[model samples]
Target: MESGPAIFAGAAFTLFGAALLLWTGVRARQGEPVALGVAPRAAVALTTLFGACFLLLGIWCFGRL
Candidate 1:
């Protein structure tokens, strides 16, 4: 696959993950539930991991491009 598309897709994924993290934070501030059936700490860990993956992937793709 071309590095351009991969870079673009990776950037999109990273942004989406960032948006999710931001939403999660807003919900937490409002005293709302973070995730169904998941502990708050675990949910945060999962979110951080997910976002980190996207960020790293995007960086890698950008480097390749």
Candidate 2:
């Protein structure tokens, strides 16, 4: 695998995941919906899960490089 593309993708995933996680936290703190029309708890859980998965995948990609 090319280091340049891997690095770019890894960075993108990491940033996106971090944004999702941070957004969820900020919205939860303000009593806003983490996802529109979804239950607060479920939305938070789902968003967090996705964020974690993305973060892990990014880390894995970076490790490969």
All models, RMSD in angstroms: 2.0, 1.0
Candidate 2 at residue 6, lDDT?
Answer: 94
Best by TM-score: 2
Q: Model 2, 31: alpha-carbon shift in Å?
A: 0.6
Best by lDDT: 2
The parts of candidate 2 lying over 4 Å away from their true place are none
Clashes of 2: 0
Off by over 4 Å in 1: none
Quote the positional error of residue 15 for candidate 2 in Å: 0.4
TM-score of each candidate structure, all chains considered together: 0.71, 0.94
Instruction: Indicate the TM-score of model 1.
Output: 0.71
Pairs in clash, predicted candidate 1? none
lDDT of 1 by residue, 41-60 (tens): 78877877786777777677
**lDDT (10s digit) by residue, model 2, range 1-65:** 49999999899999899898999899999998888888889999999999999988889889988
